[model samples]
Target: MPLRFPIRPEGLTSGPTLRPSGGPNGAPTYEMWKRRIGASLARRDEWKESVIRFFVELRGERVITWGAEEMQQYFDFWVNILYSNAKILLGHIYFQDPKLIVKKTTDRVIELAPMIEALAQYYQRELKIKRTNQKALINGIITNLGVTKTGYKAIFGEPIEAVDERDEDSIAVTERSLRQMGLLKDEKKGVLDPEKYHELIADERPFVINVSPFDMLFPVGSKEMDELQWVGQEITTFLSTVKNNPLYPKELTENLQGTHIVEMPEGRRMLGIDRDAFAGDEEYKIIRIYEIYDMKNNQFHIIEPTVRDFLHSSANPYEVLDGHPYDFFQPCISPGKDVYGTPLPKIDEAVRLEYVTIRQRIMAHIDKFVARLAVRSDGLDEATLRQAKQGDLGSIIITTDDPNKVFSGMPNPGIDPATFIHLNQLLNDLRISTGISEAKRSGEGRRKTKGEAVLIEKGSDVALSVDQDKVDDFVTGQARRLVQVILRFVDYPIALMFADPGQAEQERAVIPSEDIRAEVHFSVKVGSSQQPNPELDRILKTDLFSLAINPATREALGFQGKAPDYVRMFEDVVAAHNLPNPEDYLVDLPPPEQELEEGEEGGQEPANILQALAGGQQ
Candidate 1:
């Protein structure tokens, strides 16, 4: 019998059940969604496959190869337009360096910077392991834009406490062998030191991991911000080997006679449940688990037959990871909207056409070059004629008395001038379609003037700005969700160590309590946002410093205003330059001799101006 998951009793009409008795495959909800997903993917399979093929080509993974049987073969050449375009896009609009901000304003809140730093460290460490850092994020964004037309960066907490027995055993054997050889000191009970032993084991840090778009399946006709009414994945699992493992649900074990099951040594393997649920040494049978998430009517249902198998004897599995809006598997789309975004390759058909045309021209050029050397066949023997077909001999064998009558004149074909022009035009078309100009790709040519360079850069930025904005929004949302996950899940104290803006080593203790987490909000600041243009930064810093002492632009810049927060501005500039903390050098300045402006109540000038004057006098 076909795999069937009954969702309704014969008497029931409709309540919260997914499907009634005559529903799809007798599994009204799951089977229906499965068919929808399969159908939708079938429609997009060609496009998706094309995008993947193009990306692999650009990466040099898929090369065009021809055997000796081929009459003529063209050398595979990819201007790698997609690669260059993605690099530019990432260089400009990738993930911002995240900084956690406490929304509550209190003296005690300032103490939260260390905790915020720790949270940032946690994200960086986790993202790095999962290859979702700034650079990787850019790659994902560009790939999705160029291929899939949508990108995803999922944030889910996973246990980092699992210890690999193989690693542990290897370490133990090494230590024993070293002890026997007397290579290590025997001062303690064991040759291996406690610190060294600890170093070999994985830490107990809970971290988040990313799920690739290829690995994820969503409902058909889904939008980014829309409520994911139904989402699911098929996980693989094993059945228990015990005579009758009470934990194994009868529905799963009995109905696992489906053709899609895999047999294993210890037990049979099936799809839908977690493979890691049992150890290799453990006797178990494999089973599939349909991890379905139904969020209709504000109720999230994690329906699975094996739920009872993995649940604690006294507690339910749902109690552990109950559904929450924050925990919903979210999708982040780039250049996306109410409808799916158009892929870069699809949007630029000219590039594909031009690329194909250029490849043909190159093959023609190669054919012409090969045909340049002609073999005169007038007096050539049978063997000689065969050899001529294989290669160029430079000279022909001739035995005829009248060579001129027997042999015809060899014709030399002139090169096609129009081919070069057409090739160049095609290349230009590729550049226009991708918006990756030669200047950005750094192609060899005449060096551009500063004004020309600026113009080219401006044009590239204009083409990319819309996409960048979309990416920015996506990145910001991901960062915020990650922050929320950290806040909700991570409740331990951490001694986070990081370098301050001044490149000095600094350590801070962070104990994130529910109260602190609740009061905090996250905002992603582009790593280079503060210094959009380095030249502008230098000019502004110099002007601000000069005006600090001259009293000319000081009032205008708010140095003398009621909001005498010049210290904060100075600190920002100092941080940008990686200078030492300003608090250590700060000193209160006596009242200025000049009269104060109306509505300005400050009696003391900032220490920056006094320090500037003192340094000048010295």
Candidate 2:
């Protein structure tokens, strides 16, 4: 039911009845509104009332029913509504005030009152207690003259009653003793060094500027504070367990591996590469794999249970320095080019100095830290390396996520498809930039790789050359072998679609009368605007043309799982030709899928594929 507002009579006689005389409405102001409510109340007995007229009954609730269940539900509904409404009513009472109240109690006057009181108290304390109580007051005559006599003795070498009784003693010099002494030199300056004293200060007082908000300074007090017999007097029982509590750790001692700044002044800065910050650098990547070398055989045999962890930052490379992203004006990894027209030193000179200093420091502390870590690089097993290589990304720790949080400000078609297309274009550009390979082959009896054995019509736009017929014949043979391996793992789309967990439905408030997740199966035809190339089509018809490729290698190999592994190997080699050290970190080569055992039951199609995914890669 809608909350009906009662009519208030002006000028406060305060006795308006349901049928009062001389009202805004002829039937009486309250009476007419009550009648409208009565009509809504009477509609419960009728059957032909329109949905609009019976909205309060149908959409909300009507309290006409007297049954126990109906009565409870109505009461609950009203209570729920009033609980929200009561807060809003109280909010107005707390926040609102009459114009007279606002004008009388202004914030400007209220805020000034305490400050005025403080200033008055300060003046009273400074002026009221002076040398006025001279009628045998111990402090007024005794201590005052004693302090004066001591000061006179200190300056003139004479007692209080000595011959300097007529000498004009300036109160300015005596009162300015704090400023005259070295104690106040920091506030006034020139008492220490007239030329080189630090001008830096808080308001020219020669102090450190712009200190950290967290930094606090306190004077070391005497044992007097300990003498106080307060109830909660803290005992000084604390002891520091860390050896290098402030200055140096045993790990960074000279006997250990110690680091130093390669240079004194880093040109503009005093310090060098900050080791603490360097440890946080996201780009510091490590390859982890376990292998043990045999001194006799001179070969590294990977430990039985071995794995490789490739660490990468989800963040961009240059984002390691907070707020300072590295900019590549003209993107080229080439060593000696114009560097995209910007003249760069052999390395950034600033960074070089910093890095050198960092290396020094790390070496200084290396012996102790490395000694404790139990890491033996010479004896590093594949398993240990692999474990170390994996970036330690802990499980996601989102504690206070709101399941029902909604952002209403997103624009239509919220995320544009152009972004995805742009990203794809960028990857493709870098794909071609490094290197593109084209096989060269003539007639017959050519030297080539084994996998590159395939031959097709020359100069055909769609046909791909497997290898050169001119050189080593290993290319063609390798290409053919690679084709056979791919043919075995060629995957057709699974008949069943993997469920999308993101499609979990929300909880509806009302008991759902219908199921929305019921599958409505449908089929659609996909058509490409361009037609297939005839020569390529013919090539695909061969028994060797089925493409089964691992998804990860396909990305690194720049193929849509179509190109054979032998072809990809050639491409990778050609692309990485310009790299300074190409063999250091190459992508792992996955073995071809093998057939399942003879009597393993419940073996589904793509069992080799599924097993290749799960039974683990060779």
Candidate 3:
């Protein structure tokens, strides 16, 4: 059933109510919005609790309790298997450099492809996107859902020099220019060097914030991200940071009250911390801020629910031409039709509980059957029995004349082999359920040839392709949103540094806002950034060498009587070997002189293909 809140008339009421009525004149008050947010959070409590429990399992916490008399040893299969699998996926997903393919949608903007690609690559490095991607993927794998919020953020510092408004001839710096420069302070008064300004605040750029699943809230009936009417995030921050921020009005910040025990709506509880630690520390008092993105009303708001006040409220400030600034990643789709459907975590609590139960029982059984000595009461005294129980290597035991009648070793209570068989089957079931095979994890397979290894690797890749494709789609969506932000806000001609083809050193070019104005499509070259498979590289090298040696094959492939393109072949070989910058190792050769007629004077025979291949003098 859908969780719904009651709708009240637009007027202040005196009695307690489930829903909030607006203030005077029908303007929505902060309290009104707070009720709405509270309802949304209450609806998502179950899923949020599950996410927290999954995190506990990932950390190998004690989820299953035991009695005082029971053995309490936990074998952490959750972290042992799930974390290792997550790392394996991360290695394959981000080992190679990502290649962002930007193409012009129309012929008129065809020249902008290189500039767009360079800008995208610059953002990729400046934003540390690969790190963000790794973090998000790991979170998604562990918790079933990962989210990222992308938008342009500009931070402004105090003005260096205020120019007179009447000075038209003077180089008057506008607010926009100051924001573009992102200047912190003026080292020298009245001097503005673009290079120095850029160096001053190089860290200020667009942001991609990773939002945890616990802090996110959406409606119960929405099936997809875009279909949601609103989304809210519960943020925990210090009181001083909120007061110092420029976006919030001073009226709201000054009147705010700080509290040390603010209840987080995300079901997060603070435990084992002394409240006296924050007794007199008002500057660092922790607080909760609720940020809501209301798509239905096209409004954005930041509220302090503890004090029942709105910090900042305005129309949506972002130019969401592609979509909202949020991107979601799920390893696999949920089985139900609603957004609240439960996604399968990499490892759940039930499986871990079952494994631990069986293993602990086996250990307890073994404990009951430890080696013992069967000595007759008449055969030995108490002291002798104690000595025998010690089972010392070189100790004498006083006994009667008939030593054989005195003592006998207890028969061994051998464990049932089926117990081990059951354990093995459980492990096998786990591997199959997670789709992480033993060979894939341990890299141990009974293969006699490199070809078989390559085939196995290929099969593993195919098995993981479904999850990989989902991550790729999420990344592509983020790239599109990032491009939109760049086009809208990058109004100044910023200097971009990139490597030019056939050049030994890097080059710099200034891209004006006009250059970035183009309709471009964004895509990620899937698997291009993945780690190189050595077996696959060996196969590729074999094929390239065969093509180079077989003259008939070369002729049939239109190489005719000329040597193949050695430069391209060299680059491929370098890439196969996982070497960087193949261009640096290549030498430019002059074009072959046109063949002269029989009577012409300056004519030379073509170099032999074999001699060229061997780099030998003819």
Candidate 4:
């Protein structure tokens, strides 16, 4: 029988209902609506499990049920295999050098990366209580690129406008604090309340919390026409408190009338009482809170099934950083239906399978080593024959004097070296097929010239560039979405602390996220300064130097007849080469001393440096 919803008042059925309350004759029941969503999620989760089974190995209970039993044994080995490339690909493509560029009027407004860095630090500081941002980001990126999908939800406190407003209680406390601090000497004497003091003095700046992929689920099979303005995701998390939990929210334990209970309404109503099941001597059981996203209307229903007042938050404050929070960053999209972009591990599954097969074959070679024994028991006692046949006891004495007839070495087929060659070939194919063969084998190959090596590396990245571009698009979208959230939610001016672009000291710039006049936007630029094109720089430098040395080419190119102009031209070359300050390296020599004495006004501008050099050569 289908699980039923709890009894609720008829009045509660006017809005969205938890049960199939009275409605139009043809209206689908609440249970039916849930089933539709559940069915789609179940179908999508099957695909997720298939990918996870073959490639992705997650800790704890998997989100989806395993399809095949045989693959479970391979999880450990495949995790190792999958992680090696996943780590490299995620690192090389995006995190190797992540740059955030904010634009205003087609010009970079300020250093956006520092703001992101600060946000990342804030996330670590607030949520983790200790620093583990890198670990968190690494896991998130790997899951995004190699598993099913990835999402980042930014959790913010109440907007400044909301938090700054003080009620009558706050005003009275502030007045008391003023008197306690001796600022109001003539006012009525009163002691300051510690709770109020702490509340008033606490930092209330907006911050972020990073959500792991494993903790979240969204509509992977959603269509474009769904017009889903908000995410329809389900996030599961813990709400821990002490025994009888005075610290836990009272609203959490008080049973609410119209809420889904542990997915069904049959469970206990009181959350606190239900949690007694997890209660031990003194430890409190953590209550599981399910934050389900309602698709039609962009909001979350915070459901704590056991709680009497199951309502946590009808509307979620946090928003997904990427527009399509459900879709994942897929590096290598397979040829099949792109409902969910195929994970990198799935794309390389065939190669990985071959690798395992070869490994098993090599291990099976041990079975070929066989031994043979021939016994001539013409006069041997039954005990001796039995002992020889048993192959037990250290020494078996032959009844007859001829022992060579009883014991002999058997013909053994030794392992072939060709098997090792085949193993190596398989590994090579695995690496090449996945597009990391050159990068992984950089140390093993014959030494290549710098140019050749660069070309090789560039070519190797070509295979990954497609996936890299996809990641870039996702990241860019995330940046844009984050900005939108900040603008819509944050009313206070935020001080973005950043490293000074010109100096070593730290600097700060304030951004007002709620400003209507603000026309700022941002895009994430990855692998620009981090992965420099040295070959391009070298070529440009050589070409410019060649142009500088040849006076004929300079004249034909409409050269401004001055050495200082040539200096400016060289500066352009250096700038294009992405070097900082050409003046530091390229010092201008005093104009031949004679030109300095003659005051460099006439005399053909002291023959220009290149012209003088060319004249001497002539």
lDDT of 4 by residue, 1-618 (tens): 112233346565322233333324433334433544465457556755765654434322233343346455443334344354555554454353345565544223343444544553443334441222233334433443222222222222332223235565555543443332222223232322432332242322333234544444334333221233234344433333322333235655533223222331235444443443433422222344544544333334544445543243333333323323333344444533323445555555576667777676655654443333344556666886677656543223343466554443433246577877887887777677766645434433222355664565566567667656666665554444445444444444555545455754334555544343244454555543124555555665657776776868666666555442566777777776678988887855534433344545543443466767443222
Candidate 3 per-residue lDDT, tens place, 275-304, comes to: 454455656577789887765455568888
Give the per-residue lDDT of model 2 (tens digit) for 305-337. 111211111111111111111111111122321
As for candidate 3, its clashing pairs are none
Best by lDDT: 3
Highest TM-score: give the candidate number: 3
Quantify how close model 1 is to the true structure by its C-alpha RMSD in Å. 18.8
Model 3: worst 10 consecutive residues (lDDT sum) = 67-76
Score every model by TM-score.
0.47, 0.11, 0.63, 0.51
lDDT of 3 at 177: 38
lDDT of 1 by residue, 1-618 (tens): 211223555455122234333333343343444454465455345434554555554443224343322312211122233454555544554445544444445656566755664666466555552244433344344334211111112232333222443366545543443332223344474633633432232222334444333323444444442434344444445534322433333544543422223333343335544464434432444544444443432222223342233211111111222222222222123343222344444555566666675676566665655443343455566887776545464323333464455343333234476766777777677666665665555532223343454565466666656655555555544554455544443333434544354553334455544445434454444554211433335445645765665655555656545333467767766765656886766777555456669998754443576555554222
The TM-score obtained by model 4 is 0.51
Give lDDT for model 3: 0.60
Lowest summed lDDT window (length 10), candidate 1:
311-320
